[model samples]
Target: MSEPIRVVVTGAAGQIAYSLLYIIANGEVFGKDQKLVLTLLDIPPMMGVLEGVVMELHDCAFPLLTEVIPTADPAVAFKDVSAAFLVGAMPRREGMERKDLLSANVKIFKVQGEALNNHAKKDVKVLVVGNPANTNALICSHFAPSIPKENFTAMTRLDQNRARAQIAQRLGTDISNVKNLIIWGNHSATQYPDAANGTANGKPVTDLVEASYLQSDFVTTVQKRGAAVIAARKMSSAMSAAKAAADHIRDWWHGTESGRFVSMGVVSDGSYGIPKDIVFSFPVEIKNKQWKIVQGLKLDSFARSKLDITTKELLEEKEEAMAVCNGN
Candidate 1:
């Protein structure tokens, strides 16, 4: 067996990590053969809660899990870890302004980024799951000067999975049959769920669904599904988000099959005319743990308009995040 690799999850006592930790420890990700040391990090106040989580992890007796560490220190949690799920952040309280929320998260990510840079393995892969995730990822990448920009990414797979499920439901087919669905730009409501090139069992989704529905209802549904979930459940999504995070890291670690396009929030290299340096969701193919944006898909005028809207929103977010960084 290979040496045990360390993995860390910030906000480990939270609802999403509650589900995600089991998925990782059960060897659903990193393969059944791989050994792992799981590190769980939460704020000081949550340390007692984290100890309970650690106790539960021990109760599971996962063969692949070699050890578990629960802590409130970023240095200890990040030390030599190969991968990190940055799930902790300041939640937007009621009546909080957008700028204030961004500012608060910027501070959190900046400190964590420095911790990652100083303590984590050089090849560490970091996923920012916190809100305003795209910009948080950007700020994290900025502080981690030693790590490659590609190593830092935000979670947008939840949005992609939601879009795929909606399309599959509409067409009355298995969700597994949906392929090549792209989520463009920000992970927020401004995201563009592009179904033009998507397929269900080798049939174009556009051909199977009405154009009017795809243009109006399908787009709006995917964009607003998070809000809809909160209205119904009175809590933000947890299980699905955790599942998406697992799917994302699994595909990224194991590599995607030929012709599969998974959506990820990666650093934009001006792909499809998106501004450089912002984290944007693009349909990408992965191999050897590296992601390359899917190219040459023709975009209609309507798609272009949607893309522009999201791009504008991301640029605004970047400005607000940067202002906080500069002030501090």
Candidate 2:
């Protein structure tokens, strides 16, 4: 067999990682033919808890999971890894502002970014799944200059999945039937779940759902789904978040079907008039393992306004992250 691919996951003891690691071991992320070595990292205080998580991983006896390394050091965790998931960050506590959350997580990502730059493979793909995800991604990418800028991204896939689910439910079709939908700008409540150019089973989405609903309930529901999940369960959304991250990486690595462009939070190149410095979500297609932003979609006035709100929020978050990262 070929050498096992090294994968590093931060917050391995956290709920989302707990939900994700088993599926990845089952060859859900990497193909069944490939072997994997999982390197798990968390805070030093969480080491004992991480030990039990490692024990659980061993108990599963997955054939593809040949080795498991648990550590409190980012350098140790990220060394030579092919992909690293920056999933561990401080959650937004009650009464904390978005700026406060972004500031708090900045240091964590900065340290991880430096470790990844020094120890991880230059081609490693990094995904930031923590709260204030898009701006946290921008901060990480800023610190990891050795890694390819395009390889660093944040999780907007969860927002996209929610949007597709709402679309499919309303149209009475499978979620797979919803194609080409876009989640524009940040991952927060200001995000716009756009179906203007999307399709339902090869037909224009407008033909299947009313525009009034698309711009009203569908947009609001998809944007606020994360908070809704939290309110209903009294905990953050874990399983669905894990599933979305899995799907995001799978499609990125294996490529999506023709005519489908999923939403990904990538560094902006001023596309759709978003600022170039912040991480922003855009509709993109993956080919040759490279994600290329979809171009030439015309956004009418309403779409423009909603996108503006989210991008502005991202820009503000970027400012706060920079302040914390630079020790201001």
In terms of lDDT, the best-performing candidate is 1
> What is the Cα-based TM-score of model 1?
0.99
lDDT of 1 by residue, 200-301 (tens): 989999889999998999999999998999999999989999998898898889899998899999999998999999999999999999989999999999
Off by over 4 Å in 2: none
The stretch of ten residues in a row with the least summed lDDT in candidate 2 is: 319-328
Task: Evaluate model 2: give its TM-score.
Answer: 0.97
- What TM-score would every model get versus the actual structure? 0.99, 0.97
Candidate 1, residue 270: Cα displacement in angstroms equals 0.6
Task: Provide the clash count, candidate 2.
Answer: 0
